[model samples]
Structures are given as C-alpha cells and as structure tokens.
Target: MRHRRPEDRRPPWGVRRTVFSGLVPLVVLFGWFTLAIRLGLPSAEPVGFLPFVFVAFAALVGFGRWLARAGILLALLGLLPVLAVLLGGWTATGDEILLSRGKPVVVLVSAESAHRLKAGLAYTYDVRNPDGSTDSLEPGVGTRLPVGSQVTVVEDPDRLVAPQLAGRQDPAVPLVFACLGTASLVAVVVSTAVAGERRRVRNATTR
Candidate 1:
C-alpha cells in the first residue's frame, strides 16, 4: 500500500474554488436586496435589472485562477457601484410615494423660515426645476412649496410600507446597505486569505 505524496494528489482545482468564493457573496446580496424590495422601497422610477449583471461578473471573475488576489480586489471594487445603484433603487422605490404625491416635507429654507416637520418623517424638498420654470401650487401636501422651504405632509395611514413622514423615516435602508457592504468586504478578504494560504501550502510541498 503506497501513500500518494501531496503534490502527486493533483493540483487543487482553482476555478471551482474561485467560483464558489464569488457565489457566497452574491447569494447574500440577493437575499438582502430582495428583502429590501419586499419591504417596499419607494421610487418614482422603475427598478431595473443591472444588479444581477455585476454580481455575475464578480462570480465569473473569481474563477479566473490566473489572476492575483489584488486583481480580484479591483474586480470586486468595480462591482461596488452596481451594488450601490441597486440599493439606491430600493431607497428610491421606498420613498417614491411621497415624491409622487408631492408630499410636503419640511426642509429648512433661509434662516428666517422657522418651519420644521415632526421628527422621524419623510418630506419633499421641492425646488425649482433646473430649467428655471415654475408651476402653480396645488392643494396637495407639497402645495405652495417654495424654494428651499420644507414641509412634512401627513403620511398615508393605509399602506403597510408607506414611509413615515411624522416619526422614523426609512431606517432599514442604512442597515441593508451596511449588511451588504460588510458581506462583500468579508468575501473579498476571505477569498484573498484563502488564496494566499493555498500558495503557501503549495510552496512548502514543492520545496
């Protein structure tokens, strides 16, 4: 019965390890963003499918065994904006109700305006459109919203995910961002460390 030497056991597969490393972060991110959507993120614009593309890129590149860990870091760094944009979508979606309705949100205008919305609420900071045009103010929450003037419109009591305009705005967005960000960072760090350790082991065996 002959025992096989470590190197004789065949070089450890690289692509599989890298692919697995990339996938771990993606699954976590998907879960987070999905949950965010479920919680009803507000936005005036429709959410798009760009997040999946970047995540896929990260996963596929992780399988590039020829690349150094630093290269992997850069690849992952490039994906950050995609992730942020996706999360920004969630933020916008969750807040869209107010914006669409032109809800009055209290924003501090010049030093003289002493108006303040109730704490923990969402409001619109209506400003003149960039084209330097003005529209007649209507009788909605944001009606007569002046330049730099802030006002808080009453929150719709009916919707479950309606953003609170009076007490506690969307608090979940920051948490979701932190969770996803931390997970991505950890994935990169762990993958790099593992790659380094593997190189060390290989070197010892070859000596």
Candidate 2:
C-alpha cells in the first residue's frame, strides 16, 4: 500500500472555528426558548433531528476549505431572523380589512362588556358616533380590539378574530429565525472541528 503523505494526514483550522461558532448560536437559542417557556409563552417542542445534521455536516466538511466558506455563509444567513425581530418585520401579511361603521373614539367599557365572538370579540355600545347615531355591532364584532382602550377609526376597521398584537406573528419571521439558527449551528461545528485539527498539526510540526 502507498504511504499517506503528512500534508494530507490532518484536518483544517477553519473547521474548528466553525464548530465553536455554531455552538454559540445553539446555546443562545436554547436559553431563549427555555426562558420563553418559563415566562408563560407557548413554546414549540424542540426539533430532535438538528444535532444529527450538525454532526453530519461537520464530519463531511472537516479538513476541507469548504468548511470556511460554509461558516461565512451560515453566519450571514443567521442574521436574517435577528433583523426581522428587531425591525418589527415579523408582522403577518395578507391580512384582510373589513368594513364596519365605527365611532372615531369610543371608551372601553370593560373586558366583560366586550361581546365575545367565535374567533374574536366586539366592543359594546356605551357611546355615540360622530354622526350622533347609536353604534351597535354584532356580539362578536370588534372583539379583537382591546377593552379599556380607544382606537381611531380612519375607515371601516374590521379586526382579526384572534387578533394578535400589532406587528406580531409573521410566518416568514419564525421560519427565517429557525433557518438562521440551524445554519449557524452547523457552521460552528464544522469550522471548530477543522480548526482543532489544524492546530494539532501545527503543534506537531513545531515540536
């Protein structure tokens, strides 16, 4: 059998750095999700398949220059969700507005006073409209509007049945966040492994 050359014997440094970098995001996301659950938010079950993917990618890219490139790509991809959350870009799209006769300003009577609907709630009439007409809505209409609050009716304001707070719950937002997280984790693992292997080789050469 032909002898293995020393140059081809070891892995690259970039892989080591990628592995470490990947772990940083993983820890952060795990801590965040744990805190969210403690804070009474509904947290989705953890994805079980991610660790295997990370291991596989790291093994495949180990000692390869491609690990360095992948590390950069993943780090950049991870930023997408972060920016979306920060800039209020996580709001849902394709929202439909409906028409309803509304008073410019109405006093919130109470949560109990709001008419409960199948998916949302409606505000009850305790005040008159600008046209001085008695405003009445179906029991479930306008239910999404918060009680004890005042809203401006620029146009007929049809609200969501399960109205989330403004600028919350974008489908794209969570998906991007998850993607960023997964990619970053993989990059970290691969890069870290490569870097460690390179360090070993360098140390061996010096000795």
Best by lDDT: 1
Instruction: Write down the TM-score for model 1.
Output: 0.32
The deviation in Å at residue 64 for candidate 2 is 20
lDDT of 2 by residue, 1-207 (tens): 999899877765545455665555456544543343233211111122235334433433432333333444443443443333222211112112211232234433233344454656554433234445433322234545444455443223432222222233345655455556545545545454456556656778999
Model 1 misplacement above 4 A: 1-69, 72-145, 148-168
| lDDT for 80 (candidate 2) | 43
Evaluated against the true structure, the overall lDDT of model 2 is 0.39
lDDT per residue (tens digit) for residues 89-206 in model 1:
4554545544444334342322222223343222233223233532221121332335566444333333323333333334367446746654664566456646755775688799
What TM-score goes with each of the models? Answer: 0.32, 0.30
Predicted structure with the largest TM-score when compared to the true one: 1
